[model samples]
Target: MTPAEHPQPNAPADPASPAVELTPAAAELIRVLSAVHGPLMFHQSGGCCDGSAPMCYPRGEFRTGGSDVLLASLAVEGLDEPVPFWISASQYALWRHTRLIVDVVEGRGSGFSLEAPEGVRFLIRSRLVRQPAS
Candidate 1:
């Protein structure tokens, strides 16, 4: 069979199966941020204050260690690699069963998050993933 006709291994049959998704506004902002920051990444930690907010940084600026869990890889326009969305391992433990949706709103979040300077913020909205009936 030709390459196009060959079945791709381990590919999701449904394109929307990912645990995380981005809103149109968020995707556009990510594209803009990637242009300014070169490449970007996001991390959300379970902590007080700013740590609870989703933080975006230029890739490699924020180091992910063993304590971090990669929850999803998001496809953004103009970026070759899918942007990684991570959370602290502990945070992931609490959120593991939920689907995270990354979105943008008109407001300033933590000043440290890259989007803060743009008069907007990136936030995560989550919902429990429905289980298949037994």
Candidate 2:
């Protein structure tokens, strides 16, 4: 899909939902990366270098433990199972009330992220979730 072709937002995703999302461009790129790297996953760390940019890795490359929270599983084409998306437990606390929109931008991001070699980066845009009326 071309950059103009945006991925359809996953249905039933609302501010109250913890499931993260991927833009069409982001999904398409993931498909391409998967072709070369096999299954993929994402982790948003509360550290430097990428500045909270979502880091993509081959499944099982990055170990997730108690400090990380599995926020969502994304279904992308070319992959048999949904890709897992995680955030640092500490970061999740700060973003617990928001919805994360994962997107792709043109540039080399963290070298550790597989997509970095492709001259593209995965970043997240978040918005606060509106609490229900009390």
Candidate 3:
């Protein structure tokens, strides 16, 4: 895809804490997939079927745009570049108050996701963030 066709991950401030994280299992799986696919990225669109799950794709394979939000840029050991995680703006809207934890489980994900062929799928588990009362 043309560079102009895809949305860039936001260079958001380096917050004191990240809003997203990956499980060790998930990071290992990502390492394997990245070795095979080169670089990779993640996006959750809150669509239908597999859309509810976080989908992994070869970096830039999926086109993101204004409707998407950059959730985090995760640094996994053994990977040269940080894997950017994104979410549909609407999904971020509904989930803004939560911390997203990405995990892997035995199952099939979207046919479009790079992990689908590996017999495992990537999923997200979230926890509500408790903000200090103003």
Candidate 4:
């Protein structure tokens, strides 16, 4: 898809079939992200059967595309570098309740890891979202 094309919002996400609510938090996240550069792109790549979920990166960085949304300035602590995220309050709430940790990665070599108490571990990769040319 071209830059103008974007995926429909919060549609049947993937394998999970969990109707993703474009909650206020998510909306805010979108809004905030759009302001920095290109439209935010949410990507999911995992097991063959496991449908992907919504995870936004700097627009145009991922192969897929995403709809336009609002943006805000929020800081996630514990990160070595500052990451500007556009997210809704409800999404943030979900992260809080779910104990999900969002992180910012600089390049192919760096990122955070998810260590769940139940021995569930996820190695999250990081990529720099390219800035659109002037």
**Top TM-score hit:** 3
What's the CA error at residue 17 for candidate 4, in Å? 11
- lDDT by residue for model 4 (12-108), tens: 2232321223433434444545555444444433323212223456644644323322222233232233333333333322221221233332222
- Compose the digit string of candidate 1's lDDT tens values, residues 40-117: 889889987657878999888998987887767788877898898878878765665567788899989865889998
In Å, residue 9's CA in model 2 sits off its true spot by 25
Q: Which stretches of candidate 3 lie over 4 Å from their true place?
A: 1-15, 131-134
lDDT of each: 0.77, 0.78, 0.80, 0.32
lDDT of 3 by residue, 8-93 (tens): 33221333556888899999999999999999999888887777999898999999988887777889999999998988878876
Q: What is the TM-score of each candidate against the true structure?
A: 0.81, 0.81, 0.84, 0.30
> Number of clashes in every candidate structure?
0, 1, 0, 17
Q: Which stretches of candidate 2 lie over 4 Å from their true place?
A: 1-18, 49-51, 131-134
Worst 10 residues of 2 by lDDT: 1-10
User: Cα lDDT for residue 4, model 3?
Assistant: 26
Over 1-134, each residue of candidate 2 has an lDDT whose tens digit, in order, gives 11112233322236346557788999999999888988899988888768578999999999998788777888886678888898887887567667889999999975599988888899899876654223
